[model samples]
Target: MSQSDADAIDEGVLADARAEASVAPVPKGSLWRDRNFLTMWSGQALSQFGAQITELAIPVLAVLLLDATEFEVGVLTAANVAAFLLIGLPAGAWIDRMRKRHVMIWADGVRALALATLPLLWWAGALQMWHVFAVALVMGIATVFFDVSYQSIIPSLVRPGQIAEANGKLQSTYELANIAGPGLGGWLIGVLTAPFAILATVGTYLASLVALMLTRDHEERRAPEDHAPILREIGEGLRFVFTERLLRRIVGYTATGNFFNTLATTLLPIFLLRDLGLSPASMGLIFSLGAIGGFVGAIATPHIVRRIGEARAIPISAIAMSVGAALLPVAALVPALAFPLLVAQSFTASFTVLLYNITQVTFRQRITPPRLLGRMNASVRFVVWGVMPLAALLSGALGTWFGVVPTLWIAAGGELLACLFVVLAPFWTMRELPDAHSASR
Candidate 1:
């Protein structure tokens, strides 16, 4: 299609979306009554809970059960996120051609099947470190598609005005899962062992699949002949993100934050388990407690945006994130107070990150032309999440070379430095984002 033709299609899509929003029967601020949204939200709730179990179980299995070295654990962490770097750009183009709900359903199915193998292998007494890495890699690949579709589909399920609220609700559910899933998974791990704990994730993912299958959302699918070459489509996404000045700065801040955050996260389990001598249950409790901030942050995001203005909230949250990252090394320094300090770090990081995410994500979804939503999200993730595996591997090497505590100190410094991306930008002077009508074409 010609450039003018593509722009015309984009305008038509946005007009249709506005028309749909105007006629929506549900009252404003009432997503509860939107059955289609509720259906998708329910599926995500189950999926997030299942993911939390795997997040805890897999690392625990590698660390405690297989007695893997710190480098091995880092490699395992890298495997879990490497797909974003590998296929992140192409996945967006693919997702744009299919119904997002269908994409999400398939992703869920892939994850369920992949996780189910862990218990089967363990029961057969054939489970090994490579087996765990392979499963994690597959799950990560599925997750890349699922995550992109999940973000893109929300615009279809709710009115444009409700995007922030929708994202907040979804984020809140994720934090809720963060709070409850680890506690349950850790207890199950202590009892049934880490491999068996993975079975719970398998069950939840299947449940998520059923919920997704029941959801209905408005999606535009391109005919096979209408699709452009994958590389060209990916390039379109990259251009949109890089050329849009507001989005460019936000991506820079987020990509930097994620790099340092993953660096610390890659070794946190080992630090807690080996250095602090915490048991599985205790570690789970700390995670559960720390997630409380995220839960509260999700709930309070709209109010924060309203109070401080959306653009201003970004840098403010970035500043808070730096403070949160700083707490990690302090915990290491004063091991006597390590538990509370670590919990404090989790709380600060989760809360501020949620604040930053809801504000920026809502901005991205609102400003982008409807035709490019999938690619836009994908390009952003490709940059932000792509660095994660590299950071994970670096964390492993750093932890092994300098020890976990000192590595955490380095991670903390990096986190503080990341704030400069947003703090020094124009977002600090603005109060709100551009409306869709006035957004970049």
Candidate 2:
């Protein structure tokens, strides 16, 4: 599809989403009050929290146990995120053709099987770096399917007016998982080896898969005649993301932020272990503090939105993100205050991220058409998340040459530059929600 054709389709889809938002409303209720939404949310939350544990565990395994180089650790991280760059768009296209619930269920099952392999391989004394890479790749691929389907399903499950509230609840659980999962994973790694500690993650995935199976919903059906060639289909998604004024601006801002943030995170473990001289338990404690901040941020989002409005909330969050990034390198200079600095950074970072995510996601859902939700989400994700591997690679190389502390300083500076994106975008000044009826017209 040409760019113009894609734009036309997106406009049409946005019209449909607005139409749905204006009518076909569900009753106002707690997401917990809906059995199906609760089940789905619970399963996804378990899986997401488990993934957070592995995020810390995998790097700790390579560094602490194997004495891997910074470059090698970077490669491992890259392997995990590479799928988002390579498979995200295709997964979105595929998801658009199938039942989203089935996609999520299968994704959970695949991740469970992959995580289970890690512990078994370790027990057999056959675990190698390549095995880790392979598992990372598989899990990353599964995540693409899971995330795309998950986003596509949200509007179907809740009333339009309740989307923000629903998102806040989901973010709160996710933050709680972040609070518990990494802290526990770090503690587990302290007692058990990193490999065995991963068993908890495997168990979490299994629970998620079971939960997905038990949740029931009406299956979605796509139009038979809507199918197109692979290249054309991919082009359509890309076109919608890049050509649409609102989506394009969002994609640019988020992609830029993620690129710099990933750079900082990729070097964080190295900095903590080498420069700050923190133990695994302490590292976990710091991350747990951040998660607590995230939890508070999630709970506070609705109030923040009501007070400042979504438009103001975005820039405020961006400023918070900048401040958090800037504080990371400062932690190195004050070694005695390392943990405290990290706690502060994590708190602000988590809070800012949740607020930004809830606002953007809710706005996108309100504006996007149901039929195009999967592809649109995938397109945005492909652009925003695809930069992670490159960021990891660059950060690793920088750490290898300049040392972790210096690299952190550079990454933080880069993150501060990301604030310019919001300042320059049209979204910065736009605060009011578009009326569903007017948007549809």
How does each model score on TM-score?
Answer: 0.85, 0.83
**Model 2: per-residue Cα lDDT over 181-293, one tens digit each:** 77888888889878877887888888888987888866566887887776787787777667666556556767877887877788777778766788877888888887676
Q: Please report, as a residue range, the 10-residue window in candidate 1 with the lowest summed lDDT.
A: 1-10
C-alpha RMSD of each candidate structure in angstroms: 5.9, 5.6
> What tens-digit string does per-residue lDDT give for candidate 1 at 1-441?
000000111222344455555665445568887888888788778878878888898888888878888888899999998998999888767777889888888999999999999889888989898999999999999987887677667777777766656766776686578789888778988998888889877988888898888877776787898878888878888999998877898888788878888898899779888888888887888888877887688689999889989989988988888777878778767889988987887777768777877677768778888778767766877888889999999999998899888888888788778888888888767788876676553
Candidate maximizing lDDT: 1
Query: What do the candidate models score in CA lDDT, each in turn?
Result: 0.79, 0.73
**Candidate 1 local distance difference test against the native:** 0.79
Work out how many backbone clashes candidate 2 has.
Answer: 0
Q: Model 2, residue 286: displacement in angstroms?
A: 1.6
